[model samples]
Target: MTSSIHNEVIIFSQAAGDTIHILDLYEKNRKNTKFSIYVIKNKNIYDYFNELDLRLKNLVFIPYPKRFGLYNIQLLRKEKKRINSLFKKHFINSVNHKIYFFAHVYDYLTMSFVLSLSKNNTVIFVDYDKYDTNKTLPKQFYHVKDKMLLTIYKYLVGKQLVLTEKKAIKLLFENTNIKSNKTDEVSSKIKEKYSHNIANQSTGNSVLIFETPTAEASIINYKNTMIEILNILVKAGYKIYIKPHPYKGFSPFLRNYNVSICNANVPGELINTSGFNFIFGINSLSICRLAIDRYGSIYSLIQLFTFRRLNEKDYNIKYLLGQSNEKILFINSLNHLDKILAKR
Candidate 1:
């Protein structure tokens, strides 16, 4: 830990969902401790900040860099002082409090760039989803510029901490040690925000399928497979809800289905799912986040064979920890899924 540190925690967030996920854990821990929290807010999520709780909204200060980049020496020189000041001003007393970054960031190099600026003696990278865990990015970690940055990061920071059971570890290139996953909170707040009336709501037989960018990628036929799954569910009497990835927007293909498309202006993680009996998706990070619950039977559309594009990448690793002990199932085929649904 740093020499002049205090009982404070600073979080550097890239997305609203990741920040919300961190806050869920942080808020639970905050009740029992005297830790001050500040967030390095992502400019993208700032507009929705005011709508959140006043206490949560207050934590979203500590501005992100106006000019970005790690390889750009010009940008680095321009922002170094401001970056250092942001930390010194807010997190001077912050010592062993590890910075929490979602491990599933697309640009691992960019994440490393952020870490290079304010290295905690221990960086706690929280687990999120990645379609291709085995897909290695182009080797840019040991470049001359990166090597220079690495030395600075090491001098500023200490070790690394990962907060995933297993699947998320693949997204991390830097060496890290795993920490136990322990976070549980209710979703009445989410239901209130979304204005979902439980008394008027139907029986808990709804299903939410997250529409991801990778779902419609050229390498796969995820859309068609999902359509078939939805058809099966519709026939089996499951009220379906389709939630598209915010950045990807709506998909025209899903318009043909008998599902309600959520006009969600907020992060998908904040949507109430406890009212639903089953929540399912194809190894999506959002599903992974929501799957840690008792209200819904979480499922991964994990294939048992090389029949789908999901076979081309890493599917679900919940079995590694013990097959579905957490009530999170990984079904192999449509038939397997149907049988399970029939029993339910």
Candidate 2:
């Protein structure tokens, strides 16, 4: 008897964090598998992954369209034809092979292409953030102007979804139409592969701050609040390092503060968290993830600032962190943060 090979295709268009998820999937299934990756290029995400040591041979980068609406039907058609051609070239006689698609939910071009190829394939939506399904599904199904496109997306997805956390599986079942049989969980095994081997007894006096793109979204005065936090950390005699968000680099004003800056291209999850006594962020999924893995004392500074526009997704960080067995703290005020530092 001989084992059968699995043909898997992954399509994604998101931030550097998503690339980490895709890498995790590839690392797990690379052996005895025919893999093809299609990344809908957005910003420096492609460039960041291209520089990684993981030599993905069949990686395909597709440039995202500037406009993808009714006015650009010709452009859409051209892109669709190109994608179909690429699929045909990559998976010859795809009907005979059982093709599985692990994809993110956004990006019209990639989703449309996946719909075309999904007639004889399995399409599983990969949600990097476990709490995102509720927010994303509503926007796609209700708000999208293209009813045909929405129908195609829904039909292809067909109740299959993948999440990074196991605890979120019940939440998905309770909230969505996705059945328990079709919902799959892929743990963040990439963290284990790259995590530092620090002793359980060691507790350092350094802090690592994971920056978010709140400033880019104009949600809050990110720079001023960051400066305030930096000052508090400095006065408490703690070494500070800030990991700039992959998509949004911090303002130059942060340079005036006494803190070392990390490379913006690297994923926060990939960084070693052993040396730090504290890992801080404003509702960053990276913070919660590292905390769950018992890397450091993770903290969220979400209460210290207020967003101009409210987003439900931003509020889920606390909920997710609460599920962790480890103690993940939330900083409510600068004074409260000072008190915690004093205790430390």
* C-alpha local distance difference test of each model: 0.52, 0.58
Regions of model 2 farther than 4 Å from truth = 1-13, 42-45, 66-104, 127-129, 132-189, 195-204, 216-218, 310-327
Model 1 TM-score?
0.58
Model 2: per-residue lDDT, tens digit, 194-264? 44332242355878887755554645666677788888998898988878777667666767777778767
Please state the error at residue 108 of candidate 1 in Å: 6.6
lDDT of 1 by residue, 229-322 (tens): 8888887888887766655555687777777776444565666666676777654555665666442477777453233444344434543112
Q: What TM-score against the true fold does each predicted structure earn?
A: 0.58, 0.70
- Show model 1 residue runs off by greater than 4 Å: 1-8, 15-17, 24-49, 56-204, 246-250, 263-270, 289-292, 304-311, 314-326, 340-344
Number of colliding residue pairs in each model: 3, 0
